[model samples]
Target: MFKYRWVFIIVPFLMFLEGCRENFDYRDASGELLFSKDTVYLDTVFNSLSSSTYSFKVYNTSNDDIRIPSVYLKAGADSGFRLNVNGNSGQAFSDVEISANDSIFVFVESTFDLDTLSSPSFLATDAVVFGNIDTQQEVALVTLVRDAIFLFPQRENGITESLPIGVDENGEPVSIEGFVLQDDQLTFTNNRPYVIYGYAAVPAGKVLEIQEGSRVYFHEASGILVQQGASLHVLGSKSNDTEVMEKEVIFEGDRLEPEFSDIPGQWGTIWLAAGSTNNRLEHLTVKNAVIGLFAEGDPQLTPPKTTIVNSRFLNSANINILARNTSFYARNTIAGSAGQVSVFLAEGGNYELLHCTIANFWNQGPRSLPALLISNYTETSFGERSTSPLTKAQFTNNIISGNAGIEMLFDRDEQEAFNILFRNSILQFDTNNSDLLQNPLYDFTDGNIYEEILLNSDPEFVRDAPDPFQLSSSSPAINIGTADFISEAREDILGNLRDQTPDAGAYEFQGN
Candidate 1:
């Protein structure tokens, strides 16, 4: 009876333990980790160009840390494209440290040309793999295509190429005065190489006429610095414009701002040095410059009048006009984009604007900085000159728009010291914001009194889509203007003379 009771208790205990084990064991399995998105494949073809450029991006969307060791293009990794990871030679870019669920741009560019790179075939043939190690896991990214637009673990490479100018070899100077290219209009071909290092001091008595359709390319450090008693005759027309191109001029150096030494004239400024004066640039297109024109220092002694007519200054980093005491007569000019101001009134510069367009200028772009800019740097006292240091400029019949953020800033109570008279001008908003009709004009003394135009109506333009500055028929811009400060103005952008009353702004609607 005792043995029977013991056996019974032991059997019941074993049965209970067996039931609990089976209940917890449904199934056990292992799964592979998958990428959030599918791999990208491409067939990139670069035609007509000797070299090509490419960029990519990388993303991390996991809670665990992702470590990238290297990246490489399987096919001809060392031949077609070279890995410049953090500016070093490695298939893997950098040891990127991305917080969980964060991403960054990873760029790749080719060092050599891939003549027949265009289809998925190219990406497949040139497919690359990234090696990453995280928590002792060996992971491989096997791309599907021969050519691919792969976003990997790397930062975009901003490598620059330099133009060869006079350094090891002696350079030649084009006679600014007597220097005449056989063709009135010069074109840059593979041959006919001439570099103007330092300054292009003009020779006296001869007018250096640059005909319309003429092209002038500058080395990074190459520029024309007209000395006193010298002049430049830039002849261009609305139909045929003269081109002063910044040939491969970039503004990146080891220093804060680029110097002339690394790539001489890389800054690419058309500086009419203080002593240099009496220059003429008309119907010209000056683009991609550090400073379009810098007229600085010794205003009292510089040339009396400097004329810039019908010129387009596009995409400059700083002031288009850095004039001082220099009498400037500008007409039908366009200054915009990343430039400090269309014209910088520094060191007491005197200027007159007629039918000119100044808009979309400030510190913003790939080459940009964060700083509020003043429209004109008007000074009440520049040096010891007792002469009205801050002479008011006459901006008659001009279209100054899209620059609401910047104000006509004053220096030492100078906004009231002098005036920036805007007669028959239109302060309008850009298309980016349609409801707003004008710029936020202001004065230190006036405050909101002259803040902006309250019309709030569309200034129906001739063409409203792209360049909407042109006025339409039945528009308010016609014959609603002020009298001329110097001479009675004539000829609008359409070549129509001023009527009984001039238009409100730079353009008068001929169709209207």
Candidate 2:
């Protein structure tokens, strides 16, 4: 009887070991389906016709070994788009294998048009709906588009060309490249989107002026870095603003979440290095940068000045403007949501904010993360004694709102200290409305120094104000400016004269 029982148990155990070595069970695969991007905006330049490229990764999430002979990509009910891989034919994809939790990526370049709206088609019809026996899956893509368009007017050079010039086999500018730009001052008559991949350096020895209504685009890890001693004059109006749009403009390669440090210093920064003095930036919008403008150079007694008038700094990881011994006269500038501090000055530099709006800095709580700090220190010696030899900043007449952690913190030591002068600025404590969580009027260490003059009320904004930051006629910021403190050529971001008695923060109320 004992011998018979052992034989039965041993035979079953041998059978179970054989089953464990077999292929993965088809019913056990379960992976979530997700799309690469949430929104896709179609610019009107292409006339409702567009094509983008993308890649898809399929993963197997089960304990058993699974097989995917072929994978099929289908968009919409009628199979509007398809992908062919390595000379294999299959409406149902195959030629694959997966062990428990393995995956595969399928690269696809799909073209779709919105010519028929009533019969409306999907931007990305159901991708990867067919084929594949096991494991839940997902699809992702890499979008592609044209970067630039050139337009030329009829001149003595006998040239007449428009935007969207067809490209030749080499993907170079076919029409505009040959036109000889004889005049030192030339105009690009084109009105289309021009994409910039790497550093788009303009011509040397001549000023490059972009007319209003011109749109420029930049790819990932790319930006416009004006070298030392260069000038860029951007002419834009509210109605027809000259736009510089960047899709994947990443300044530092270290901040892409879920996949940190994919490419360190993959792209250089927008360096407005020394000799970039007296350059004016007006009515421009800069987005998605590691550091918006990192200006550095030796200081002069009558220092070099860079003025940012009526421009915006949005969605950057580091300082919007990092000046080292460079003086900046920023007026009516709007800064929104910095991963670190909005403005960082170092080593005997000066910055003046007149009628400017700084919102949403250090939106994330300060816990080892970069807070919205204005410092006179370097990266290596941060939180330590101040090695920076500079006077305090002059933050006069500005509206600073929406900071999560420490709002405007100043750091320095006795021999190397920096102070803040908020003569007539409104520091609205609107973060969560819980006055306790809001940043203090002044966040200064025992050895630091600063000053502020807070009015007892919020400066009421006017109805449908031109800028959301404008002060109403009845607000407290009107007729409260200090003329002696501001710069002589100081102008608001809107090009308005800064002449309030005790200047209200960052704007000159129209009626007042």
Candidate 3:
């Protein structure tokens, strides 16, 4: 009788323990699954090019472990959209589980063929459908698909050779097997965008004239090379007041996705060979490249190697304007946000920047260089330095500022003549040191050399908005420029006329 009493007590305790376990609720509801985003827009992908993977999350807000009865693409197996639901890649998935208060990821990718479509450019769209008992939801997928003229290095006999770029640090000519533009291919109209696979070289005596509103996209390590005696003329006009998109010539990476828009070092440099001359750029925008402009001109030439006006260079990995033993003239130009120096005048050069802005606020990485660097000597591969004369380095009504303490570095060899002049410009150099302030390099006391310069004062820029380089209303640069400096062209970069006493830098100060 005692044993029977103990068994009954244990059975009751076991029943109580079973009742203490938590219960799960699996009722189907319309809003049971929460999505990270309602839509996913992929980049403008070329024909036959694989797109980058885009992902979204599906969260189970319900208290129970919810099992999605079906997850599939609305377009089914023949659709361009490929879906991977919780690690399983297929047209459809069944019984996809998400634990209570947990989430699962769904990745999508696509590869489109333009020949399959009836148009040159089209919008590819589909939908990711999720279903359960009496409930359904969807997330839209959209991508811009285009047919582009892809240029790549031709392979012969199973060997891919490159074109001759230039001299290396050892003073040796380096050659890579790249595609050389033929005489017929020199002119690029406002047709569909050209996607370059390797470096594109304009042969000697050829001219590559890009018309207005032409878009040129370069692949990784690909750029345009103006060979010796070749010319590059980019003729772009200011956008119409009523037009939504600017008519400026654009040079950027081939990737049109949002993530890679601001990424630097996407392509190589636009290199002007040693003897390349008569190159001009107007109303152009070059961004996300290794180097925006690399001009190596023959020092013997009298006229400027290249002339740029009303152009902008943004997000270069290294120097935006790298001129070596060259002559370049720029007006109403803005160049900045480089990994190293924004404008590097190395091995001596002749440069005149008028009403231009050279500022480097590169927050992408650790930048040790300045915004403007002028060096008369270049280090060779043998650790020896070769000195070149900096005939004329002039900055008038320009703004030279950056994150560095000293935004301008003038490394002059004692023997070589370093002729540099900063007139009516706002310089971001520390003047706290009495000795530095007194020095002619920092101070503009010498009438014949420097004059009317503002040192170490903030220009009060409008930082990282639509126009980051524009001067605010309270900027010290306003009404501080020499009226006679910009006498020829009364208009600033934005087509705004300068006042009697103009503001400095590329822009005229319109009220806040």
In order of appearance, the predictions have TM-scores of 0.48, 0.54, 0.87
What is the per-residue lDDT of model 1 for residues 432-508, given as tens digits with 9 covering 90 to 100?
Answer: 43322233334212432332232223445554434345667776655556555325457554345667666655455
Question: What's the lDDT for all of these models?
Answer: 0.46, 0.51, 0.86
At residue 332, give the lDDT of candidate 2.
69
Candidates 2 and 3, the one with greater TM-score: 3
1-512: candidate 2 lDDT, tens digit per residue: 99999999999999998787664454332334233433322222222223343444455565566555445654433543445443343335654555566655544444444355333223344455523446545343322222234222334566442222246645776432122222443343224344444454433344456666555544455555444556566665453233633211122321223233322223334556566555566676665667777776644424345777777766566656667866777766777666665666766566677766665535344423232355555544234433565554666666665534335544444565455566556564323435433434343221233334453245565526645556777877676556765575366555566653645655676672
Model 2 misplaced regions, further than 4 Å: 1-190, 201-206, 240-269, 301-303, 361-372, 377-388, 417-420, 428-452, 455-480, 483-503, 507-512
Give the distance in Å from residue 307's predicted Cα in candidate 2 to where it truly belongs: 1.1
| Alpha-carbon shift of residue 88 in model 2 (angstroms) | 8.6
Best by TM-score: 3
Against the correct fold, how does model 2 do in TM-score?
0.54
CA displacement after TM-score superposition, residue 347 of candidate 1 (Å): 1.7
